[model samples]
Target: MARRGKKPKGRPVNGWVILDKPKGMGSTDAVAKIKWLYFAQKAGHAGTLDPLASGMLPIALGDATKTVPFVMDGRKVYRFSVRWGAETTTDDTEGPVTQTSEERPSRAAIEALLPDYTGEITQVPPAFSAIKIDGERAYDLAREGETVEIAARTVEVLRLEIVDQPDAETTVFEAECGKGTYVRAIARDLGRDLGCYGHVVELRRTSVGAFTEDDLVPLEALMEAAEEGRERLDAEAVEAGAKARVVDFAPLDDYVVAPETALAELYEVMLTDEQAARVLSGNPVILRGRDAPVFCEEAFATGHGRMIALGAIEEGAFKPKRVFGGRG
Candidate 1:
């Protein structure tokens, strides 16, 4: 019989890749491609961007995967164009049009209605969404000809405004919102209120957490960089007579940001080597110095510039909630 518990392959590459995912590619596929390029043992993404949407998709490798929740919880910014006079089943261009109207909302009408969508408001997720229905995905059920009714949930929209009026048929909008705010839903709701049906014709996520356009590395650029890096590695291996398939990963390091980038919103506490050691072993350590925080709901500790743990500070002690790599 073949061994069942074989060790996983790939290098233990750790960090984030702020990928500018192109349209027509899903977030999972983007992460998988990145993982393959880096030859990472484990990989995940901070948030899911629909296959129909493009732009920033933060791919996390190895230890960086641990910080994904923090990034997911952070605010997201999206710029999208909505096609007036049409509503789609998926609330995006990928879906078939379910309703249409000849009427179109004027640019002034959209601007005036923006406030109603901003702040905390309730909205229903699209039928073709990742939301679960009776333990099955809503999209899966919807695809199987089953009706999916997602409950109305409150979402925080920090800002929603008309950015451009491309034509009478389309209007561009930019929104900054908390987790679970769907851009598609925003477009759909706006169209309904304006007496015209609408759906997202073009959607792009510009920012998530600390990740922004500045941090974006286009998919093609990454592939090109990987090709060069892999070629160099292969040549070095041949010249040195090293064992084949060795992944140095140093050449591609320049493209990856540190894992701590996801925790930018959290307080950082620099620890002594001894304290770091204790934290890695899942122990709490007393923080000293006059400037030390007496209490923090969430904080990350680093020693020698390496992440040690993410935890809370309570009564002058930092408690390790999630420990990272062994003490460096």
Candidate 2:
């Protein structure tokens, strides 16, 4: 017999859902769809993909939302196509073409130009972007026909390799970039640097953090599964054929990088069980680890009062920052 317990509704499912976002749907729309499907009380996405782009989008359900920032901070890889001789207002096919040229650079020219952008560089974001300027979104300002002058921010381009040169008019490339790097902006900048107008004709995120396209589930499959009584579906079966599918609870740790991974660069300060309990109760503890310089600070609980990990030392031992595994 099926185990009798609380129904799935409002019963938060911990960990992340790697969604293979479909094109033409907004990222938030996808999150809302998943939230409704899972009947989860809290849900958030680690990163946003443009409506024109598609691929892995990590959706954090329940307490996992607290760790979304860590996932977002991880590097991203993308496979994209940039069409030469055309510039768009939004740096993508969805936007209006503002300018065009007859000249198309050869693959050799494009490859040679890549070196100029292959390392740490400053990139000016597209005006029709989510970047905020003076308390307003740059896209909002651009929509209002207002001038939006955004400062160029430095971003690392770990790699930019030409995967395919279909023709002199278009170049297919793959890039691995740090957080806040924009592929659309890369398209725009590459065009400008090469003395030709360009915009991304196709873009697909291959990976975000440790999640990848191979781990995503199609939204349609998810919707169908939800309609077919999601609770009855085995977690393993749900993930069997999809890039993103429901994972078994036992392997939840595989999908979620423990919060401690965020503090890998920091010094370790293990605590006694009593010290951990005290930290859970909102008390600062002193750190006495000999591996690093001695310091003192308070470690406090983080995210929905779940004490699962310890915080950095300030005036105390690393205290319980998050707690997990209890009746919700």
Candidate 3:
């Protein structure tokens, strides 16, 4: 007997789906929804987006799940709006207002502050974030009404441009940054720098790696497609045919990028059939023809128009660190 609302047995759908994650939904909940809609036997996300922040959430299905780490290492772009005059406990709208300031910085004052935030800078992760403290989540500690002091870490901020100043209370901006850079922390710091308490009122992630806003599929659209697939399967079952328990929501090859695409930043090596076979079989292969890139510890090996494995370049040899498809 199946439990009510339990998702049916899923299919091994290997690919990635860019979800324009709606506002007010946790990253975990969004993943669960995407999984159910696709009925994928395996699924994972490249990065976590808080409930308050919406936009691109890269969902990987089946074999694509193996490429998540590579995707997460890529740069992220965010368009966020900060509301001045009040600082929140969480550094976002969810927390209570902790401080308020009557003085708001003019556009010129804000523009002058921009140069200081760009490039490599130290940033402290917000107390209400997923960062672990003493093996427990920092947000968990914060929710339990505990004071969480996070250490400052260096994060590269590639671009920080003021896009708009709609009113006296809010300012909109776009940011391009590296992994581990916290927008909440930026808002908090900006507030302090300008002598006006501020917190993020709205945030939307525009891109993650090669996945961008153009690739995003709305949650409702995916759900509708899945429901239609279920109906078709039920009809087939009535005709004594096996029920279609699995569905590939998007064309894996056409819509979802190949695994090599995610490792664009890494040096790639093309392997012969025999070399690929050995690499996939958990064995190292010698690259006799060319010298490996200097300091190239990580690489992607490709063969037959597909990614074979992610490996380490050690001693002029490609040592398979993690193969794409589990086994040869």
Give the top-scoring candidate (TM-score): 1
Per-residue lDDT over 24-115 for candidate 2, one digit per residue giving the tens place of the 0 to 100 score: 98999999987866766788998889888989888888767766776788888999999999999999887799988887887878889788
Query: What's the CA RMSD of model 1 in angstroms?
Result: 3.9
Q: In model 1, what are the clashing residue pairs, if there are any?
A: none
lDDT of 3 by residue, 1-328 (tens): 9668766367766778888899999999998987876667888999999998999999898778888998999999999999999998999999899899999889899989989999999999999999999999999999998989999999999999999999999999899999999998999999999999899999999999877788888777776566554534466577885755434454332445555666678889899988888888899888876565533688889886688788788878888888876573
Better of 1 and 3 by lDDT: 1
Question: All candidates: CA RMSD in angstroms?
Answer: 3.9, 7.7, 5.1
How high a TM-score does candidate 3 get? 0.87
Regions more than 4 Å wrong, model 2: 1-9, 230-307, 313-316, 322-328
TM-score of each: 0.92, 0.76, 0.87
lDDT of 2 at 304: 38
**Per-residue lDDT over 1-328 for candidate 1, one digit per residue giving the tens place of the 0 to 100 score:** 8768778798877889999999999888888888988888999998899998989999999889889999999999999999999999899988898999999888888888988899999999999888888899899999999888899999999999888897899998899999998989999999999999999988999999988899999988876676655434477677888644424556567889999988988999899888888899898999999899899999999986788788999999999888887632
* Model 3 per-residue lDDT at 246: 32
Q: Over 4 Å off in model 3, which ranges?
A: 1-9, 233-255, 288-295, 326-328
Q: Model 3 residue 123 lDDT? A: 90
Output the worst ten-in-a-row residue range by lDDT, candidate 3: 245-254
